[model samples]
Target chain A: MVLQILFIAIALAGVALFSYNLKKVIRNIRIGKAANRTDQPQKRMMTMVKVALGQTKMFFRPIPAFLHLIVYAGFVIINIEVLEIMIDGIFGTHRVFGGLGALYNFLIASFEILALGVWLGCAIFLVRRNIIKLKRFSGVEMTSWPRSDANYILITEILLMTAFLLMNAADAKLQAMGAAHYTAVGSFPVSQFLMNLLPNTEGALIAIERGCWWFHIIGIFGFLNYLPYSKHFHIMFAFPNTYFSNLEPKGEFSNMQSVTNEVKAMLDTSFTPPEPDGSKFGAKDVNDLTWVNLMNAYTCTECGRCTSVCPANITGKLLSPRKIMMDTRDRLEEVGKNIDKTGNGFDDGKSLIDTYISREEIWACTSCNACTQACPINIDPLAIITELRRYAVMEESQAPASINTMLGNIENNGAPWKYSPADRLNWAKES
Target chain B: MSEQLNFEVPTMAELLAKGEEPEILFWVGCAGSYDERAQKTTRDICKILHHVGMKYAVLGTEESCTGDPAKRAGNEFLFQMQAMTNIEVLNAYNIKKIVTGCPHCFNTIKNEYPGLGGTYEVIHHTQLIQDLINDGKLKAEGGESFKGKKITYHDPCYLGRGNGVYEAPRKALEVLDAQLVEMKRCKSNGLCCGAGGAQMFKEPEKGNKDINIERIEEALETQPEVIAASCPFCMTMLRDGVKLKDQDQNVQVLDIAEITARANGL
Candidate 1:
């Protein structure tokens, strides 16, 4: 009984710690150096429900998507049981599914089957990422990703799910043996059979079950805690990524809102121009962005959907929508660490774009919203691309030579063509 | 090239009472009043307005440019100033309706100008022309004689994607007995005339594909005798492309108004 109470106390402490860290990480992502969204909600909700759950976009390439879908759906259904396991397994009750005992047994049996399928699906993903070295994942780095990153990502996933399954197997054996003193796992068939193997060995079964339960909970929770700290934080990032989709009409550019202009109007009239000490117009780090854009950085599952459809990326430009997300993630970590150490924020001033995205990479985008449309979780790449363009044009006086020429023409002739405004009417008389 | 021409002007009251008080502000954009061959297209549009007896008012010099170029080139302030100037003029005349010959002006007035509180029903001149012809109020000549000569329509950016005026030009062409050979990139996918986004003012960016010339080549591919466009900017760019490619020996860039005028016996 004392052991059960102690286990509950530890679990409670861990949960609290996890929740606090999550809140902090989330805060850093949201208000960080991203641009303001101007997103449509109704369409976003439809897309989120359809793509995120229905896995519709995956059908664009069936095999890999189907494999991943298995894992995704398994995760969703298994989460309910995972919660129950955390409760009864830790507190030594073993009563969660006992009321409709047969139904409970069937649920566990089917879940175990799904888990195995998920494991196999993840393995296929591992092979594809490592062996195929898909071009979509290769952003403007001008070279392919090293094999180790893919392998590591694959191995990590394998470890996490394997530990979970093993932990389940260990506890189920204890339950099957009807051991009174140990944690009972809810994983089926094997646990039931193994428990019978040690029916008279309840002493042994109890010790093994307790060990397994702790490992399963600790390992999975540790991975959870590590998610925001890693590249695979897509596990947590997909939530806000879907929420902050562009509200503006699809294929239409955002009506550029000069927040600085608004702020100046509201602030002191003497508010000096060229605010060398003001909040950045575009993201320089994760913290300089809005909560949604920052969440995009964390949410990028590295699926490469955005990069694949990008005309600029396909035409050999240096812009990759995928890399933008990754770069945002990298900058967030760097800037977050700085804030932790010095407590200095963006208001005191810092270079934004150079710290976050490369100057050349910014000019390559054509502002296509394909990324948002193709995203399973409604990530908006075009918005980020435009924000960078805005910064480059407004703050840095750096725009494509073509854009500059176009601007000059507009200034001189009130048109993009070089013909004198006088000649503009020369065509009207000949018919 | 220069021309010796005889033209007639309709009185302001006659033009205004044709539609109603600002029901249609017959916007004579710069191209309509001044472009060499395109002026006939403009005059043709005016005669159609006269024949249809639609109540409309000419914006005259008050409607010179919608500042589409400035807005597209990232100079919103100038664009806004232009909008303010034009909107004030339109508002003063109680002009809540606009009919335009220029696609750029149409897009700017109908779409972009609304951001600055200028909102009204604006129809492209092609639409007006199509309506007049469809109603049998306007008549045309020489379509059978020109039947063997292939022609194609080029979509001006401001007319198509920049706004959403796609059908009227085609409808106008159909009434004129002109065959429209569609380029690979037509309608919403129409290539820029190497003129929008302020390309009209400066040299085009060095690209493997000069969008205007590329579009012209598409017209050439169809062996069209002329490239039909409603907007003056498209007309000018296409003309420049024809000249650049020396395709004017066979192909020509003609405004929608001109084609309709030919069919209307103006």
Candidate 2:
């Protein structure tokens, strides 16, 4: 009874801490401007199912994709076992669902099989990351904690899965020996093999079982808390991220409504336009962007698939789509921290445009939609790049000289050239 | 040869004054109206229109830019100004079923103009030619020059990826007895010509190689006698790249309209 109370206390504490951290991150993401992505719930939900749940985009590269699929399925399905763990902990009972008989046996067997797959998947991923040193994984942006974070998660997962199997094996052995609290219930097809190695002592068996059980649960709690700080946050955010992805035509740039309104007022003279809203033209800071943009930054997997397929990056330009997303997320986190330290109206005096993402990087983008297409989670890095460019040109008027000249030509000649409108038809004689 | 084909191309103002509504408005975009090489495409399209006897008129001096380059260059004010002016002229003429040789213009007018209340069914010239041939209104002469030539079609980024047009230009190429080759990256995965997003108006930033040179190198891999393009920007970039490699003399850079014009003995 004392043990049951202790287990419940620990579980509740872990969940409370996790929930607190999650709420803070959610508040941070909401600090950005309003956006209306509430339309087309059916389509959005369908996209979530296909892209996030079904792992549709991940299957582009067969080998890694297959391994990722195994790991992903294992991680999701193992949570069902965590539910049983919670129940068993709260009631202080061994095999709490053991009353279901054959059904309980099937569930245990399935969990064991999935745990084995996850173990193998993590092993292969470690080899691919540390040994093979995949180019995308080891890029300049991935040099420090990014690399370490990925390794840490994989190692943690391996340990947790190992602990789970060990606990199941020890419990099975104790049950076979007619131990007191250890019921002869459930199956362990894979872990049952490990029971032969354990000593046939009730005290030692209970210690092993309890140690593995505590380690597994504690590791899960640690992982739950680590998500907001790591790129692995995609595990939780990918579904909602894909759900809120841009459904418009890929090449269509969203028009600035203020400019559109001004043009409409000018064209239709009877309609009186309101004065300027005193808002900046485009995104110069994190707060200028829509909440969905902030969500996109937080959901980035940092997998560099977008960067790998980017023409600008492939051609050795300054732009890297992955870096753009990373910079946005970093700046957002910094802003969140500033607000936390000070009040909600705190000013960091550090903007995302020149402070973190340089003009050279912004200008190098080809706007080919390749990066967006390549993202596994449907993150649109190009939208962020375009928005920043909009801020640079429209807000600050700091566009490159050639772009300024082009804009001038458009203003004068109604085209991208310096030729007079009267001379527009001169090329007809050549035909 | 020019004296034999003197079709009277009327302006929208003239057509409107004559109390007539043409079947289509030929949006002779900036490139078609001003760029030297693209003017030939404009004329070829006109020649084909004459042959097909389709009632079409251009906006002439009243036509402004499509504001594609301006909008892409991040100057929303100038883009809106240009778009508003163009939309005003089109609405005044009550223009519908427009066609252009430029994908930039096609994409802008077809997609962006609707927001500004200038909506119309816009088609690229290749799509028009494909339809003409499909309807048996136009036919390519069998003994046309460059028959069975190894011709590879470059998918313009705006036309292919931006607007989902991959088959119209290919169908136009198929009208000739030419073998249509493809680059390593074609269709939905086709690389840009280093000219979209107003890159044509500025020199490429420091990189290992210009994107067009890379694209042209891919085209050369197919050993194509003719590099076919549907967008004038792609044509200009690919031609410049071919010239840089000193292969311009060997390989011809022609628009689909030009190819179709030649096939029809225009």
Candidate 3:
């Protein structure tokens, strides 16, 4: 009864903290401008299934993709065992679904195999990050915290899987000893090999099994709470990120409606422009960006696939797409904290422009869609860069000198060059 | 030096005044209009049109910039200004079908113009050429035969990845008797020619190497006699890269339209 009470309290607290963090994240994402991503529900659902569920894009890098698949599959399939654990924890029962006979045995056997897969997969990932030091994981933005966070998640997953296997091993030993409530219900293909290492005494075996059960459940609850603070948040956000991603032709940038209204008034004198809403021309900070962009920043897993493919970054430019996302999320977090303190809105006097992302970084982008194409979860760093550029050009009226000259020529002349409109047909007269 | 072919190119205004409408509008983008090297490509496209007996007319002086560079430069106000004016001229002509030699113009007219109440069927020159080949209107039998020569097709950013058009340009090449070689980065994975997104108008932000040089190295790896390009921006960039490598004597950079016109004896 005491064990059941402790289990219930820990489970409830874990869920409560996770819900609180999730709500905070959703609120931060909602602080940006509204966007219409709700159109085409069926298409969005299909994208979520293919990208998040099917894991199609990850196959671009075959080796890491295969390892990731094992970890992902193990995480999903092992959750069924977690469901059984939940029921057993709540009722103080041992192997409550063990009554399903052969089916339960099959499920346990497969889960044991998957736990081993997860262990192996995570161990390799740790070596790749720490020992081999993949270039993608060592960008300037990685710093100490992001690197440590990745290591922590991997280590925690391995520890949890270890506890799960050991729990099963102790339970198997107890079953063979003909102990009450042990019930000889599981078929442990992998864990059976582990049973010989466990102590043979009943009291020692029961203590090991119960200790592992408590440790496994508590570790999961801790992991659930750790997600929102780490890059691992992608596990939950990837579905919505892929679903809300841009579905139009990648080259087609969205038109500014505010600019359109003002242009119409300028071109046609009889046209009546709507009353000025006093909104800025383009994004000055997170508040000016669309909600989807904010969500994209939060959804970034810091994989650096986008940065790896960027032409600017490839040529040693200051721009890194991964850093852009990290900056956006960091700025959004600052804005969220300011709102919390003042209970109103952002007034930090520090915007996302010069304070976080630099002029050189945003300007270096080729506006190529390589980053968008390379992102496994479809996060668009180009959109954020363009938005910052828009703010610099339209609002501040500051652009590179050559770009200004080009715009002047387009305004006075019909073309980007100094040629006259009448000269447009001159090519036809040439041989 | 080549023989001068005499052909009459009609403008939309002239055709409409004569109580006639063209089957398609040839959107002569800025580069196609004024750039010296691109004018040669423009003439070849015209030659192909005349040979095929397709009724086409240009907007002539009435056609303005498509605002592709302006929009890409982050000046939405200037972009919309240019776009609205161009949309007005295109709408006035009641143009239903259009083809462009530049992928930038094709992408903007096809994708961006619709949001501003201007919608028309737009296609790149390569797509039209491919369709013409499929319909037996254009063939590579009468003109220059590339039987033993190797040629490579450089995918334009706005055409290949910008729009899903990997097959059309390759189809145009496949119709010729030449061997089509692919760069290490081709089609969907194509590298940019360093002239996209208004980069053509300005020097690139401090980098170790220019994007065009990077792409040119990849193209040169295939070791083809001719590098076939579709976009005028790409044509200029590729030609510059070939010149920089001093391979202009050994290698030739030709537009797809120019190549097709030579193949069909236009």
Q: Top TM-score: which candidate number?
A: 3
lDDT of 1 at A285: 48
User: Which of candidates 1 and 3 is the stronger one according to TM-score?
Assistant: 3
lDDT of 1 by residue, B105-220 (tens): 77668766675567888888988877776787765663323454577888775667555667878887775555667987676555556555444554443334555666677778
CAPRI docking class of candidate 1: incorrect
Tell me the lDDT of model 2 at A99: 92
What is the C-alpha lDDT profile of model 3 across B1-266, one tens digit per residue?
Answer: 15355877899999999999999899989999999999888888888888999999998999899999989989998899999998888888888999998999999999999998789999999999999999999888778887767999998888988898999988888888789999977887788888887889998889898888888888898999999999999998999999998899989999988888888776
What tens digits encode model 1's per-residue C-alpha lDDT throughout A297-323?
Answer: 777777787777654454455667877
The candidates, ranked best first by DockQ, are: 3, 2, 1
Give the per-residue lDDT digits (tens) of candidate 2, residues A1-431: 99788888888888899999898889878877777787999999999999999998888777889989989988988898898888988887777888999999999999899899999999999998899988888555775888899999999999999999999999999989989988798899989999998888899999999999989987898889899899999999998999999887677877778899888787788877788777777789888888888999999988898888777777778888988888888898888788778865337678888888998888887787778878888899888888887888888899889989988887878777888888776655443
Candidate 3 local lDDT, A1-431, one digit each (tens):
99899899999999999999899899999988878888998998999999888888999889999999999999999999999999999999999999999999999999999999999999999999999999889877899999999999999999999999999999998999999889999998898899989999999999999999999999999999999888999999999999998888988999888889999999999999998778787788998898999999999989899988888888878889999999999999889888889975567689989999998988888777888888999899888888888999998988899999999999999799999988899888765
Model 3 Cα displacement at A401 (Å)?
Answer: 0.5
Winning candidate number (lDDT): 3
Each model's DockQ score: 0.15, 0.57, 0.76
Task: State the interface C-alpha RMSD of candidate 1.
Answer: 5.6
TM-score (C-alpha) between model 3 and the true structure = 0.97
CA lDDT of each candidate?
Answer: 0.63, 0.86, 0.90
* Residue A246 in candidate 2, Cα distance off native in Å: 1.1
